[model samples]
Target: MGDELIEKAQELKTMIQNSAEYQKYDSCRHILKEDEELYRKVNEFRKKNFEFQTEGSAENGQADRLAEAYADVLGQKAVMEYMNAELILCRKLQEIYGLLVGDLEFDLDFLQ
Candidate 1:
C-alpha cells in the first residue's frame, strides 16, 4: 500500500511539474537562481514582509511601511516576475489542499 501511495505521489508530482503554472514558476525560479544578488535581495524582502505580517503593529502603521517596502522590492523586474509565478503555483497547490481537506472534513474544533 505504501509503495502504491509513493507511486501515486510521484505521478502527481510529475503532473504538477508538467503543468503550465508550474512550468512558468520553474522557469522564473531558474532565472532567479542564476542571479545571486537579485535572489538574495528578493529573499531579504520576503523575510521582512513575512515578519511584518506575523508580528505587525497598529501603533505607527508598521504594516503600511512594510507594504511600501515590499512594493519597492517588487519593482525589480526579475523579482516581480518570479514572485508572481511563484504565487500562481502556491495558489494552485493551496486549491488542491483545500479540496482534499474539505473532502476529509476532519473535526478540529476541539483542537482550539
Candidate 2:
C-alpha cells in the first residue's frame, strides 16, 4: 500500500509538471533568471512578501513598502510575466491539493 501511494504520488507529480500552468511558469522562470539583477530583485521581493504574510499584520508602513517594491519590479515586463505565471501555477497546485484533502476530516482550532 505504501509503495502504491508513492507510485501514485510520482504520477501526480508528472501530471503537474506536464500541466500548462507549470510549463508556462517554468518558461517564465528561465526567462526571469536570464536577467540576474532582475531575478535577484524578484527573490528579494518574495522574501519580503513572505515575511509580511507570516507576520500577519503590517507594521510601520511595511505594507506600503512592500507594495512599492512590488510595483517597481512588476513594472518590468519579464518580472510581471514571471509573477503572473508563478501565481497561476501556485493556484493550480492549491486546487490539486484541496481536492486531494477535501474528504479528510481534521479538528485543530487550537492552532488558531
Candidate 3:
C-alpha cells in the first residue's frame, strides 16, 4: 500500500508538471533565467519582499518600500509577465491541494 501511494504521488507530480498553469510558469521562468539583468532584478525584488514579510510589524514603512520597489519591477514587461504567470501557477497548486483536502474531509479541530 505504501509503494502504491508513492506511485500515485509520482503520477500526481507528473500531472502538475503537465498542467497549463505550470507550463506557463515554466516558460516564463525560463525566459527570466535567460536574461541576466532581469533575473538579478527579480531576485533582488524577491529578497526584499521576503524581508518585508518576515519583518511583519517589526519595521515601519518596510512594506511600503517593498511595494514601491515591486511597482518599479512591474514596469518591466518581462518581470510583470513572469510574476503573473508564477502567481497563476501557485494558485493552481493551492486549488488542487484544497480540493484534495476537502475530499479527505479531515477534522482539524480534533487536533486542537
Candidate 4:
C-alpha cells in the first residue's frame, strides 16, 4: 500500500511538472539564472524574507526595510513577472496539498 501511494505521488508530481503554472515558473527561473546580478538580488531577498518569516520578529525598522527592499526588487518588470508566476505555482501546489491532507485523521487535542 505504501509503495502504491508513493507511485501515485510520483504521478501527481509529474502532472504538476506538466502544469502551465509550473512551466511558467520554471521558465522564469531559467531566465533569472541567465542574469547573474538579478539572480543574486532575488536570492538575497528571498533569503531575508524566509528568515524574517521563520523568526517572526519585526525589529524597529527591520520590517520596514524588508518591505522597502521587496518593493524595489518587485519594481523590476522581469522580477515582478517571475514572482507572479512563482506565486501562482505555489498556490496551485498548496491547494493540491490541502486537498490531499485535509481529510486525514489525526489526534491532536493535547495542544488545545
Candidate 5:
C-alpha cells in the first residue's frame, strides 16, 4: 500500500539521518572515508529498484500498478536525498583538497 511504502520511506530517511556514519562527516577526513560507502549503497539501491521496476512482474504477483507507483516515488526521493548528501560531501572535499594543495581560490570563496 501507498501508506505503508511512505511510512517505510520515512523510516529509512530517519535511519539515514540518524546514522553514525552520517553524523561523523564533520571533517573532510571522515567524509572521504565514509562518503564512498554511503554513495555506493544509495546508488546500488537505486539501480536495483529501477531494475525491478523494469522487470514488470513480481514473483509473488503482489506488485500491482499502484504499489509500483508508490515504490517509484519512494525510490526517487531516496535517490534525490542521496544525491544531495553526495553533493555536500563533494563540496567539502573540494574545500579540503584546495586547502591541502595550496589552491587559495576555494579558501577565498568558501571562507566568505
Candidate 6:
C-alpha cells in the first residue's frame, strides 16, 4: 500500500514535470488544483492514522509503537518532504510562467 502511494506520487510528479500547462500562468490554477488534491490526501492519511492510534491504544505497546512508526514513515513527514520537493519544481515552473506572462513580482518561496 505504501509502495502504491509512493508510485502514485511519482507518477503525479512526472506528469507535472512534463506538462506545458505547468509552465504557464493560464494553467497555474490547474496546478494549484493538483497540489490541493495532494495536500488533501496527505491530511486524510494523517487523520486516519491519528484515529487508528487513538482507537487501538489498548491493544499493546507493541502495536501502538508499530503504528506510530508506520505513521512517521508514511504520514505527515513523508508528505511534507514530497510537498517540499514538488514546491521546488513548481517554483521553477512558476519562474518560467512569470517570465512569459511578465508578472515578475510574484514570489514562489511562499509555497515553501
TM-score winner among the candidates?
Answer: 2
What lDDT does each candidate get?
0.83, 0.89, 0.83, 0.87, 0.55, 0.59
Question: Weakest 10 consecutive residues, lDDT, candidate 3?
Answer: 57-66
Worst 10 residues of 6 by lDDT: 24-33
Which rank order by lDDT, best down to worst? Answer: 2, 4, 3, 1, 6, 5
What does candidate 3's lDDT look like per residue over 1-112, in tens digits? 9999899889999999998999989998898889897798888887877776786842788767667867866677778889999889989889988887767866689778
Give residue 72's lDDT in candidate 3 (0 to 100). Answer: 68
Model 1 TM-score relative to the real fold: 0.80
Arranged by TM-score, best first: 2, 4, 1, 3, 5, 6
Q: What is the TM-score of each candidate against the true structure?
A: 0.80, 0.89, 0.79, 0.86, 0.30, 0.28
Residue ranges of candidate 5 with Cα displaced over 4 Å? 1-75, 103-112
Clashes of each: 0, 0, 0, 0, 0, 0
Please give the lDDT score at residue 104 for candidate 4. 100
lDDT of 1 by residue, 45-102 (tens): 7777677677755346876776686686678788889999989999999997787566
lDDT of 5 by residue, 17-100 (tens): 665545543333344336576546555555665666688545555345444554544355444555556557557656645665
Report the lDDT tens digits of candidate 2 across residue range 1-112.
Answer: 9999999999999999999999999999999999999899899988888787789656667877787857978789999899999999999999999999999989979899
Q: Write the per-residue lDDT of candidate 6 for residues 1-112, one digit (tens) a residue.
A: 9999899778866876666544443244344346676556555655665666789753657556555655644455446455455566668767755665695466779799
- Candidate 6's displacement at residue 98, Å, is 0.5
Among all candidates shown, the one with the greatest lDDT? 2
Kindly report which residue stretches of model 2 are placed more than 4 angstroms away from their true locations once superposed.
59-61, 107-112
lDDT for model 5 comes to: 0.55
Residue runs of model 1 more than 4 Å from their true location after superposition:
56-60, 70-72
Q: Give residue 102's error in model 1 in angstroms.
A: 1.5
Per-candidate Cα RMSD to the true structure, in Å, reads 2.4, 1.8, 3.0, 2.0, 19.2, 16.6
Evaluate model 6: give its lDDT.
Answer: 0.59
